[model samples]
Target: MTQAQSFSSTIFRRKPVVGARAPGQAADEPHLKRSIGTFQLTFFGVGATVGTGIFIVIPEAISMSGPAVILSFLIAGIAAGLAAICYAEMASAVPVSGSSYSYAYATMGEVVAVGIGACLMLEYGVSAAATSIGWGQYLNELINNLFGWSIPNELTAAPWGVDDPGWINLPSVILVVMCGLLLIRGASESALVNTIMVSIKIGVLLLFAAVCFTAFTSSHFSPFMPEGMAGVTSAAAVIFFTFIGLDAVSTAGDEVRNPQKAMPRAIVGALIVVVSIYLLTAVASIGAQAWTEFSPDDEASLSRLANSVTGSTWVGDIIALGAVISIFSVTLVVIYGQTRILFAMGRDGLLPKTFAQVSPKTMVPVNNTVIVCGVIALLGGFVPIDALWDLVSVGTLAAFITVSIGVVILRRTMPDLPRPFKVPGYPVTPVLSVAACVWILSGLAPVTFLFFGLWVAAALLFYFLWGRRHSKLNTGPASSADEVSQ
Candidate 1:
């Protein structure tokens, strides 16, 4: 066997493949089922990409860059689109499920894979928490608008979030727990559900745009570049969080009917759709009110803009309802991603074997899903939205940079390997993609950087203490299970 093939199989501890296993194994496929298609995958991308940020993060983006946040979205979209192309190459070349962790393992090395996993936790885990926190706010908006009463702060904030000073956020925790239950029960967000949620998310924002446009005044753009280039780019960094879900497009690699044709189109297509929606919304919101009014604590902020423009509570109520539903779905999709990554790690022997185990009856990674749910629940229950945002941005940007860099490394090592779509401008495209992501990453708050440093350090420590010693590679390709118990 070729060295890369031998190396990949051995390190992942999988049975030697005499032939390529089909996309999704049918029978003995252990939590593996060919139940998706290009449409559904695209729907997954759209659904996961829509919520949280567009609803709430918009206010912050406005507060930072004013109407120039429109410029920020344009810049961030180019960067996200560029990095996604790199990710597509890695996903296709590596042929694995755990996103960057899998790509790093197959192409980079064991140590890189473990470290990337740390970043994935930030990308998916912290993102799930951040998204859930948004869900709580929207839910309260819906409840208050519909019933004229909202849940008490103590019940909604985590036991840990600044209770007057509690450390945790309660509503977010409850949402996470509910998602965990659904996942454990083998429920998944099907294509229809994803599409419906995406529609709701986009619809709400579009609704805001339609209503707020009535108040449109060209004067809103008077001080267009008021923040200067530095502030615009910095706002781009904060606004960049909304773009993190674009990577969801890459993860659907295996299921597309014709990945080569379908992938490039879907990713670029999705990027265009998202960037347009964001730009339009920013313009509308800015027209309705000055950027300074976008307080971080403003509950149901966008919906409030709707009410402001229409002079009726109905518009805001509808926006709040849409935000609540869409954010909940986004949380579920992100959490599902986290469990699958852990499952891949377990299968590779990097994590405990129990993680990869699937309940035969349910055909889901019950234990792994449960563990992830519990951890995320704790974070959501206590951590505020502001704290989770930077960690998510930093983690995702780091991983994107790795993917962009990986494209260069893979091209050098496996020139002959078939690639459906070559990143348009190989060396330049990848290099630019990396630079753009770094610029945004540079603007992260100091505390976020410190936390990210600690997270990466912890991953490295675990790799040396356990991951490296127990890696499937050390024992050899699918070596008898006997040698696996480090």
Candidate 2:
């Protein structure tokens, strides 16, 4: 092949989808064991999702859209639902651990897959760090409420995140390490813990809804669209990060039982549960308190709202406790997703081989998980949460758009491919998903776009320098699991 043709082939090369096992499998070949079922998989979605977003985003959204944040929730839900539908098709068809990165690889090309992997890193790894910061704050609040004393600011706050910077966020580092150890134990144990946390999360939110509704008066919702559709759209963009858990569910495709069936179900089920809870909580919050009272800086907004409704501090204490647990689960699942994405990149020869090596005893990516957690712990301990959070919504929306487009591309390019679950209303659905994400993207701050642009550029630069030459697709056709050998 000419140099031009070879270069073209390198960038556009795609991977073929095959069965789960590595080709020429030996009795001792390492692979991610399939232990997750539909039930645990659904909790993975809920646990990763129902975290600091609901506790924090409600107030943030209300500040942006007034009581019309209700409309914002609906708009964001529709957009997320459309994306989830497209994701379901991709996850079911690809059935891999890399989420949208694998889908883009199979449909778009290796270069696009690298870009998608960059986006996933932002969505999972950075968000894990951000969530850890939130968890530390909530843990402090819970402790103060229960014992009338809290961790010193030097131990709980980041070095540069606020007016009062501290030496380090020790709790944030602790949280990340705790989640990493759980992941190293194995996927099933992590899933069970996540399920329990999700249940508590749901219960706490329901409790908030039940109590808030009792004090609910129709007066607060009057002039619902006060700031109009512009406000709703902007708020939707702000809160869109909450919906990313639906996509997180797909990252476990390699470890899920009957992935063709469970993958789609888990994605759809998680979307429904997350959207419903968000809507219910949004409505209750607006009804219980005039939207004007919400402050953007309130870290314990939900708990504060509960306090006003009950005229006591006990309910707020419980809400803070729940927030602590919820953020832990979020940090855990986001770290899990990040490790798996790196594992996939490693398996494709895009990253170091150590990332792809599954531990023989635990059937998990122990080294990869440790590396991911270590990086996240450093970020959480030293970096400002504000600097880390804006990128998450931008990254997540970009990845969702990729998945929607990939569904269309795969359908056209690989018409004969087996798809256990096909996207409903194919052409229109994917098109709408793309449009919705783009509209939300437009509403993000200019700083966020700048950050995103720089991140993507860095990712492509790495690909050209190293990944393009070393990619497995360049070597030859190999099964997806071929690179996982010990």
Mark the regions of model 1 whose C-alpha exceeds 4 Å error after superposition: 1-31, 159-168, 185-191, 252-265, 477-486
Q: For every model shown, what is its TM-score relative to the native structure?
A: 0.89, 0.95
Clash pairs detected, candidate 2: none
* lDDT per residue as tens, model 1, 366-439: 89878998888877876766778878888888888888887897687667666666787789999999999988
lDDT (10s digit) by residue, model 2, range 1-486: 999987776787777766643222233544698999999999899888887578866787898899888888888889999999999988777787888988888777788889989999988878888889888777887888889998998887787866678899998999998999999999999999999999999999999999999999899998888888888888998788877788789889889998888999999999899889988999999899999999776677888889899999899999998898898998889899998888888887888788889988999999999899999999999997778766888889989999999988877767666778898897999999999999988888898888888988999999999888787666665333222221
Runs in model 2 lying further than 4 Å from the true structure: 21-30, 478-486
- Model 2, position 44, has a per-residue lDDT of 93
| True-structure lDDT of candidate 2 | 0.85
How far in Å is the alpha carbon of 227 misplaced in model 2?
3.0
Error of 1 at 163 (Å): 7.6
